[model samples]
Target: MSLGDEHDGQTRTRLPEGNTGDPYATPRRPARGSRSLIAVVGVVALLIAAIALANRGSDTPTGGSDTTGGAGAPARSAAPTAASGVRPVTGKNGEIPTGYARDEQGAQSAATNYAVALGSVDMFQRGPREAIVRAIHDPAVTDGLVKRLDDSYSAAFLANVGLTPEGLAPSGLTFVSRTIPVGAKVKDFTNDTATVEVWCTGLVGLAGEGSTKPVTSTWFTITEKLRWTGGDWKITGSEQTEGPTPVNGDNRASMADDIAKAVEGYGGFTYAR
Candidate 1:
């Protein structure tokens, strides 16, 4: 996911000093591994952002819709969208769940599920990548989209990120890429088409002993253009933008084994609106 690019976008923040004798009063420089982790995570973040920027369709907006008052419209509240008591989807297209209702709630549900599929570690592999694209994308755009994604995940790019050409990690290492949707809301809805925004936080990197690229978390929002076709909602196109990122908290990072174990222990959910 990262190539150790020469981008220095990290901002170092210092916590307030408690007391002169306090051990935390004097901040120490991060270890060499910590520095590498930060740099690699930044590179991958930029890489994903660049991909989203390039793949965006002409009709897609560069940002999420503004909730503030505009064009004489009343200001919309910033509160989270209320759930509509919709149940989780009961159908499956391969491993991906399908069979969404034709409404705003269904559109939001589709967008969130698609976001998870798009951000998964499976997307790195060719076989699973094709299955995911075919399952979730509109049929008319599926082949072209698959080709584009394959090109994006070329062998050289995989090598740069410490994975094999087939997207497998080295011996004794585990690759992790998972997207957890924070929330989803419909932006525009119609009988056959809808636009939805899904806010997500994801983990992406390798995890294991002596792994230089430790797993890292990132926040991003994905905008999906969905069309109700073939008895289910399918993606026409999508875009992503860097987050409504929160300030970094003062928590110590966990060990790589712990991350790898957690990823394996916990299962993902079938998100619903």
Candidate 2:
């Protein structure tokens, strides 16, 4: 079949050098559309950083909202507390937030956070990578996911971006891939299974001077079809759509070193409803 050309709105154009796009626009949701998710398995070498500046504060007041996946949903506040308290539960592995999300919103939180862990830069390392795969992905899909990622972050691919043999970030360089859920809504949430859609902005890139792959922020929606397995939510299957995306405002970009320092200094919070 012939591929469709990218209309300014419908098409998701991948940058020729590095991955960059508005993560929140609905990129023509074909049943099997390429979600513009140009995967970031691990950081290989010196790279650029992915930074999602908080525009909610007085500084970031462009009201950078769009109509992509979950449109007109007021927009998740940057504050820590809300009616839905879905904090991260400390786990044996690292941190897995659970408890208090009793409805569809809760389920959405669970699914979104799971996606965060699954899409983290830590997934590049060997041990943590496997643990995350098993943690968030469905058992049936785990093997297939691994195989695909292996191809996606192969030796040649890693070399192009400057990673080590197994996709480790070069020393002193910080690799970041964080998905901050703006909000979530449940189409059908139950005690067992829930379908949740998360509005998210993700940071993907490396941090350092002279880096080719600089950090970039993306706005995208992750519609998670979560299963109530392992005493918590696990992804059965998920689809990604681009946007509720907005224009790249003419904000002054941060310095490369400052970007790295900010990523390191700042702590990602446990999202609550």
Best model number under lDDT = 1
lDDT of each: 0.62, 0.51
RMSD of each: 15.1, 13.7
lDDT (tens digit, per residue) of candidate 1 on 125-155: 8998789879988988888777766777788
| Candidate number with greatest TM-score | 1
State how far residue 79 of model 2 sits from its true place (Å).
Answer: 12
Q: Model 2: runs farther than 4 Å from truth?
A: 1-81, 84-93, 98-102
lDDT of 1 at 266: 69
- How does candidate 2 score on lDDT? 0.51
For model 2, what is the error of residue 118's alpha carbon versus the real structure, in angstroms, after optimal superposition? 2.1
What TM value does model 1 have?
0.72
- Residue 97 in model 1: shift from native, Å? 1.1
The lDDT, on a scale of 0 to 1, for candidate 1 is 0.62
Off by over 4 Å in 1: 1-84
TM-score of each candidate structure, all chains considered together: 0.72, 0.65
